[model samples]
Target chain A: MEEESQIPKGRYAADISSINEAHARIKSLILKTPVLSSTSLNAISGRQLYFKCESFQKGGAFKFRGACNAVFSLNDEDASKGVITHSSGNHAAALALAAKLRGIPAYIVIPKNAPTCKIENVKRYGGQVIWSEANMRSREETANKVWQETGAIFIHPYNDGRILSGQGTISLELLEQAPQLDTLVVPISGGGLISGVALAAKSINPAIRILAAEPKGADDAAQFKAAGRIITLPETNTIADGLRAFLGDFTWPVVRDLVDDIITVEDSEIVKAMQLCYEILKIVVEPSGAIGLAAVLSESFQKNPAWKDCKHIGIVVSGGNVDMAVLWDSLNK
Target chain B: MEEESQIPKGRYAADISSINEAHARIKSLILKTPVLSSTSLNAISGRQLYFKCESFQKGGAFKFRGACNAVFSLNDEDASKGVITHSSGNHAAALALAAKLRGIPAYIVIPKNAPTCKIENVKRYGGQVIWSEANMRSREETANKVWQETGAIFIHPYNDGRILSGQGTISLELLEQAPQLDTLVVPISGGGLISGVALAAKSINPAIRILAAEPKGADDAAQFKAAGRIITLPETNTIADGLRAFLGDFTWPVVRDLVDDIITVEDSEIVKAMQLCYEILKIVVEPSGAIGLAAVLSESFQKNPAWKDCKHIGIVVSGGNVDMAVLWDSLNK
Candidate 1:
């Protein structure tokens, strides 16, 4: 665990006002994804569970909401040169599509090891791809080099204020659909999704518990929160590629302060949740998107006192862009 | 070919008016399922196509629309005693749920060989199940016995006018959503769905070409249309379990008169279409549900002069409640 004093000052500074403004700005541009009741999950947990299906969102993920908000929020002068971002998959495809909609060029720095399907998705959406080595340093260096050369603004995948504010729209929509939610369980990677959701949800009803569901293999958020400071994992590994990020500087403090708990679930739990979603719900949820349900189904959550009497629970199903081959392998395992 | 003079009277008597009334009666009960465009299929076919996703409907098939309509069309006295139907799968589950919603008891007659998953679905939705031999005679006899014992109204799976009307709702919704649709392709089983869809679509716009898609293995509808009479095969054999039915008395005439052509797709084509739906559309579709798409994608339709200049095409994707084990094996094949 890292020291508490190492925490950043501005990370937890976001409030409801900014999130509301973000909602207003991006509401027209993004899809108001449906919030569906999970009868099976609810029955199993003995709790009324509502899933905010961001998996059905444009670009097949919640990242589009943030990417769109960020790209559109930029001023005319800043937008002309376009935006640059580094992502292994979802974020790059999302940012590319969002930028294209705004008639702006997008420079996406992708790792060489990125999935072929994701790479094809990025290219299909008209994003310029700049391939880089599969390492944080190489990705950062490539993004910076592109930004410096082309005067394009660097859109950090999770650390950006605009991105967080955009992602907050999901909570706003969820609360609107299911106003009686007692708790919100969100999967945390760089904490962008949870930070935005927590800020918006907590601001609306501070009593609503905000919990983070993390993969046990990628438990940076859990470690960071326990240490009361940001703690970057030296290496990350998980089937849930979307939730394998080391906690971002801007997101760690927000997650540390606002999120009530960080629950970790095994990769197998995620696989099981994915199977359930596919078989019972008839919805294609990627492994990362199933993390919240996995966490709830995990023994840890069943034993947690906070979940004992929760009347209404809201879970964000973040994305559904999964490779069929990988999914088949995971299910067989 | 069978002689035209030998055709059954009921098979030649159906028209568009009955289908219209059915659509109006059941409009409130059934969902206007979304029509989604598949970028992958469009690229492959070089023809702009839209999939009417009945797979997302209640009970996981368009069968629910017909089932609900048929159940609710019952008189107050008949409804009070409850309803009974014989189906190996989708229809049983659909009728069970629809009857449950209307506060009526539902009796399902299933073959002992029916998939366990489907049997559980009927029970899950509050239907009493009665097992019968895996043959049409046993199923009908069991249903009749249940009706006789309980005074329950018998809702024929596909033979009744009310059921046909209910299935016609899909065409009504599809035409309303895509007004420019030049051609409509629908799968044929006992011909209830196609008969209804043809009536609704042709009535609304006589210029629109209506086609029936059938599996080659269970090409009873195709044979009937070709013969200008109803024809029952010696034995039914097909992977498209839903399409393995002889045209019913009420449905035969509606399809024979209204449907311009009956296109037969191979079982392999249906499997491939199902796989494409799962992989590209991110929706689970049973082999039978994909027959319409298979017809459009197969060599028969692709090389047809009628399809050469077609701008808009609509294919009814009937259901998604597939046995995952069967799907896994089929996918491997």
Candidate 2:
């Protein structure tokens, strides 16, 4: 993995600057969530782990940051045309809220199988919903049909430069909140959050090791890293529905180069970590949000030499939107 | 309910100064927990609500603050003698942790029927535990026997002057965190936390309204207010186990004088509030921690003329240590 070659001879020199601008842009519209630590967690891990709590952000996730930035970055003419997206999770609600913040309309295409609460979350933020069959083809077709009819810009969940740049701001704030961290452990989905954070951290401090945690069930990112090429899973499966998506074109190069390690954990491990987070941190973190901590406690990771030297670790708790059924199961178990 | 009469004019002249000193004394040992807000909660209550999250406090409760202050305020001779308390809840764990920080022994007397997790919490902090029958007479006799044998100073869970003064530090931090709060809602156990907070808030602004929230089943504090004198309950009952204790001698004066209202909520309402706090706020608040919010939503409180004028409210989330069986029941039901 060539670090500098990933950028194709440095055409993205302004990525950090864009992230700084995103921080300023969304400062008023979104929450700058707090960084939290637990002595109990630290003792168990035998490392100083700081949790950057994006769970407290509006819409209960860090996606709101990028969604706001993307909506606000549009020019007057494009802004008036509004935006559209196909999602049934945090992104839909995020884009809906972002559109509302910008005083623009948002068209959301949701799968019929999406939870009622999630759909209501989008509607609560004033998103116009269009339902489709539970498949990628139908979702995209419905979204594209809406986009063509309304002439609205389609906001990709994670692939866009602006969205990743907005997500990069999390690392910037984290570094300022707790300086001199030797490592960062981030959960990888389409690599939006981790890619943005890795680029920002590497630009500022080349020695800061950026590690990616992924579910073994839906581990395309880890497979791609090992094979040195992108590979899409035929069928994805994980309790962490948010981490099922594969890496996108825009996020691949940055993650392949800047990410120091890509480790995978079993679904059972992820659920266990989720329970630990709920019990010790007393916060309702979805399975996806607990993956980073799961990787920290994984047998493979603990046996690695890097674990010995990495003293101060920053773990990004990406989101906190858990379905009540799943949460009840986890708690009642 | 004369404010100045409670203090006896000549005694306790610099109450706020003592709180400030407590803040200084235990600054490093305790967390200055975050103040959180939820748009959904505000919309439901029709008021600007800020939650002072002491559930995020060390030992899973705000009791740690007072416990630390009591342990550290000791002279060397007194410190060497150690400290003791009879509690099977957050206060016992808080005292144990506080004593551990000051490098002193802590003797804890617990009922034989106490939950295993709570007993573990005390032991985890290096406290020596003695088990007794589940009754006030047995609990007190066992505690006194331990005190007589070890010469350990007895720290009342909420009644002692130093402990209440230490609890007062919460209001100091809360006011700074959220200034101009028209109403302060606090849960009453033995009235240690509320009395301290009320006194501190009143001293700063005489017009600030201090309100008490109590469980209907364990409404001794409310009964005391109605009768214009203290009256002990024959038997206490509530889902909010942390709020089951009767009001103490020192707390009665401060609460009776400074507190404006004492509202009670049914256990069902407390559980409903607990679930809401857990789901919407994404925080695991025990029933006791959620009582204040329950009071604000109560029919009696909602119909009050004073409620119409109060625009900004601060609710103190007192603790987060709930029995898993109880929590599971709360969630499952």
Q: Give one digit per residue, the lDDT tens place, for model 1 in B71-162.
A: 88888998999999899988999999999989999999999988676787898889999999999899989889998899999888888878
lDDT of 1 by residue, A29-122 (tens): 7878877664656788788888888877777789998899899889999999998999997889999988999999999999999877678778
Q: What is the TM-score of each candidate against the true structure?
A: 0.83, 0.93
Model 2 lDDT at residue B93: 93
Q: Per-residue lDDT for A1-333 in model 2, tens only?
A: 344443433454227667778888887888878888999999988899999988878887889988999999999999899999998688898999999988999999999977666677798889999999999899999998998899999999999888988889888888989897999999999888998898877766778999999999889988998999986567887878788888988899888878999989998888778766776787877778999999998888888986789899999999887766543443333
Total colliding residue pairs, candidate 1? 1
Model 1 chain B worst lDDT run, 10 consecutive residues:
B1-10
DockQ of each: 0.22, 0.37
**Model 2 residue A22 CA deviation in Å:** 2.2
**Which is the leading candidate under lDDT?**
2
* Whole-model lDDT values for every prediction: 0.82, 0.85
In terms of TM-score, how similar is model 2 to the real structure?
0.93
- Model 1 TM-score, all chains together: 0.83
